[model samples]
Target chain A: MSLAASQAAFQAWLQQADDAGIAPTLADPRGLSVYQNNYRVSLMACLSEAFPHTLAWLGAEAFEGAAARHVDAHPPRSFTLDAYPQGFVETLRAIW
Target chain B: MPSPHFGPHFGLGLRKPHYADFLGGDVAVDFVPVDFVPVDFVPVDFVEVISENFMVPGGRPRDILRRVRADYPVALHGVSLSVGSASGLDADYLRALRALVDDVEPAFVSDHLCWTRLGAFQSHDLLPLPYTAEALALVCAHVDAAQMALGRQMLIENPSSYVSFAEDEMTEWEFLGELVARTGCGLLLDVNNIHVSAHNHSFDPAAYLAAIPFDAVRQIHLAGHTARTIEGREMLIDTHDQPVPDPVWRLFAEAITRAPHAWTMIERDDNIPELAELLAELDIARDIAHQAAADHQVPA
Candidate 1:
């Protein structure tokens, strides 16, 4: 794959767990899990940090469910994590 | 553009947990603990702040950075430059960073060599790039554009990556050296990153260190990483959540010997401890630098 195609595939795999898309270009398929874990954990942490009060109100289990759903649906567009929290209000409303 | 060579300096990343300590003199903020008292100034040469955090128009983030700038020389480190992107540089991002650079008059401005944004999808994580000639040329062009926009030399840091592409035509060190040669940008050698990538990819850390262009190295980052097993194979993740391990410290000692005058700092983003605790870690860097200075002298 070209650099652009490989990068796009890697981004898709990271955001969507579409491992099949990136597995071909990967030097080691096992390391793909590490990147996936990093993407999910960092995004979850971003949401948890952004909505402390909402997390408190919704409780950990429910808040995590919502955050995970948001993460699955919304592939972050902003380069900064600070801008990621802006969409969580809609997620909270849609779920709760 | 001038060099980012700011004499032998040691510092720490200005994290949220220690905001009170950085903003000393009885300046009470809502986030600070009520029992927190004003302490003496932190004994360090400089402090680095994440550029994206303070890229806003007006807020407490900007206020905190402004106040911190008054106390110590600040280094504007960014994560969103995405220089390795094949598409091009982001004009808005560069403009905001240039504004921050103008306001801070930072000791050095730096970002990673990896791309974080691709097209409309921003990964927010440092994604690896295949070290091919095409990617190298693209990165060099972006670095040149960034330096031109900022009107100062910029430093590019090596990334700790988990994956390497099969099509890579060069090593990360060679790519970085060529980047410096082509664009005249300095380097921020994160010793921990070299250790992590070396361990993950089964490369000799010493070899990578030896291949580095030490004269272009203006700053160094020391961070802790976590070790984990993936598919029953041990891998090191650049988690930045623990104290500087022994091996990373050893590598740092070797790095300081080669690039003695580079600015050194420790990064702890998660599981952040007390200011004094990190201060102790910074002291470790000081000791290493002191010993390296005695052991090997870089001519002025």
Candidate 2:
């Protein structure tokens, strides 16, 4: 596959790891889980970092649930994690 | 390209918890411990802020940054340049960053060397790149284009990586050396990232530091990481949520011996302690850099 095609496939696998599965093109598929976990955890942590008060108020389990739903609904569009929390207040309000 | 100017100094990541301390306010924030004293003045040499946080059209972020900028030189550390993307640079993002640079006139602008965006989607993570000749060429081109767009030389940071590619032809340090040779961009050598990537990929951290072209490094970042056991193997994740670990501080001491003039900062993104705590860490960096300079016989 071409470089562009490889990147596209890898990204697809990253975004939808459970459904798409690791691309056969990668070196070792076992390590893919690390990247996948980091992807979700880091983004979720970004929201938690931005809305610490909300997280403290809602508690970990509830905040995690809200953040997971928010992540599912809104995959980050911008390159910075700061942009990931743009509509989080509304998302949390709706969920609550 | 004109070399980015960053005089030798130590600073802290200007986090929100310490905003009132830096920007001046009576707003009661709960994240900061009550026992912690919020001083009226922050005497750091510079304040590094996430460039994206201030990219908004107009808001309190900008106002706080403006007030803080007046007190100390602000360095714009971006996470979104995505210079290693195979697709291309984002035009709108570049435009917005350029406008911000114009407005803030930061001491320097820097971002990770890894790509965060692919096609229309942004992963919001510093994804690793294959260290091949083709990837090098593409990254150099993108870095050049980004510098052109911003009308200033940019610093590409070494990202903490979790995996290595089979198609790799060279080490990351070699890629960074070639990139600097090609694009004339500076390096934001994150000591913590070097330690993290080295441990994750099984490389010598000192070797990584020795391989770096010291002259090209304009700034250094020190941060904390989380150690996890994955598949019975120890993995150091660059969490940046706590104080700078001892091992990373040792690496920073070694790094500053080579790049003595680079400005250094402690980056604490999560579980941010009081401004005094970060400043104290910055003081440690100041002491280490001072001792390293003396050991290397470089006049401070």
Candidate 3:
């Protein structure tokens, strides 16, 4: 695969855990799990930070569940992670 | 105003919890939000801010940054440069950053060597790049483009990575050395990142430090990391949530011994403690750098 394709495959795996994006191309895909974890954990941390008051109200378990759902629904499309929280309140509204 | 040249300065990442300590007035002594504190309260040579935070139209954050810059030399560190992207550098992002640089006149502008964006999707996390000749050329071109846009040379920081690609050509250090040679950019050597990447990839941390272009290094980042067991194997993550661990401190001693002139700072994003705690951590860094300088007979 080309460089762009390689990165796209990596991004695909990171966002969707679709190893088929790289299962054929990669020699060892064991580390992709780490990247996936980093992606989710970072976005989750962003949500937890951006909505601290909400987290305090919902508690860690509920807040993390909502954050994971939001993360799965929205793969950050902005250059800054600060923008990722723009529509997060709607996620909470929809869930609650 | 005198130009801000990078010296062997000790500093910390300006987090929200410590804003009062940084911008001093008659604020509360505890971690409660306050209007301000004393200007010279934190006691550091410089302060580093996330460039994207102030990369906005006039706001309270910009005002606060300006106030802080009046007291300390500010360093603009970015996360979304994505210089390693195969697509190219984002023009709009560069323009926004250049505006901030023009406003701040910071001590330095630095971003990670890894890519965080591709096409419309911005990962917001430092992702690894294949150490291939093609990637090296692309990164050089992007760095050149970024420097031209900013009207100054930017410092490229080494990122901690969990994956090593199959199409790798040279080592990460070799890629960085070549990048510096091609783009005339300086280096921000994150010692904690080196330790994390070294353990995750099973490479010798000393070897990585030795291969670094010490003369080109302008800053050093000391941060904490977390250890997690993935698939029954241990892996280190650059979480930056806690204090700088001892192993990273040892490697930093060696790193400072080599790159004595680099401005060093500690970065703590999540679970940020009080300003005094970070200042005390900065003291440890000061001690290490002093010992290293004294041992090497280099000016501290």
Best by TM-score: 1
TM-score of chain A of each: 0.91, 0.84, 0.91
The model with the greater TM-score, 1 or 2, is 1
Top candidate on lDDT is: 1
**Model 1 chain B worst lDDT window (10 residues):** B25-34
Stretches of candidate 2 off by over 4 Å are: A18-30, A45-70, A80-96, B1-7, B26-38
lDDT of 1 by residue, B1-300 (tens): 434454578899998878888887434566586667777788988999999999986888898889888889999999999998866788999999999998889989999999888888888888888899999988999999999999989999999999888778999999999999999999999999999999999999999999999988889999999999998989999999999999999999998888888999998888998888999999999988888887776542
* Rank order (by lDDT, best first): 1, 3, 2
DockQ for each of the predicted structures, in order?
Answer: 0.79, 0.51, 0.62
**All predictions: root-mean-square deviation over Cα?**
1.6, 3.0, 2.9
Question: Number of clashing residue pairs in every model?
Answer: 0, 0, 5
Give the Å shift of residue A80 in candidate 2.
Answer: 4.4
Q: How do the residues A19-72 of candidate 2 rate in per-residue lDDT, one tens digit apiece? A: 242346544444566677877888898899899999999999999999988877
Residue B76's lDDT within candidate 3 is 97
Please state the error at residue B111 of candidate 1 in Å.
0.5
Better of 1 and 2 by DockQ: 1
* lDDT for each residue of candidate 3 in B178-258, tens digit (9 for 90 to 100): 999888999999999999988888889989988888888889999999988877778898889989999999999998888
- As for candidate 2, its interface RMSD to one decimal place is 2.1
Best by DockQ: 1
lDDT of 1 by residue, A8-74 (tens): 8888788878877688776888888888888888899999998899889889999999999999989
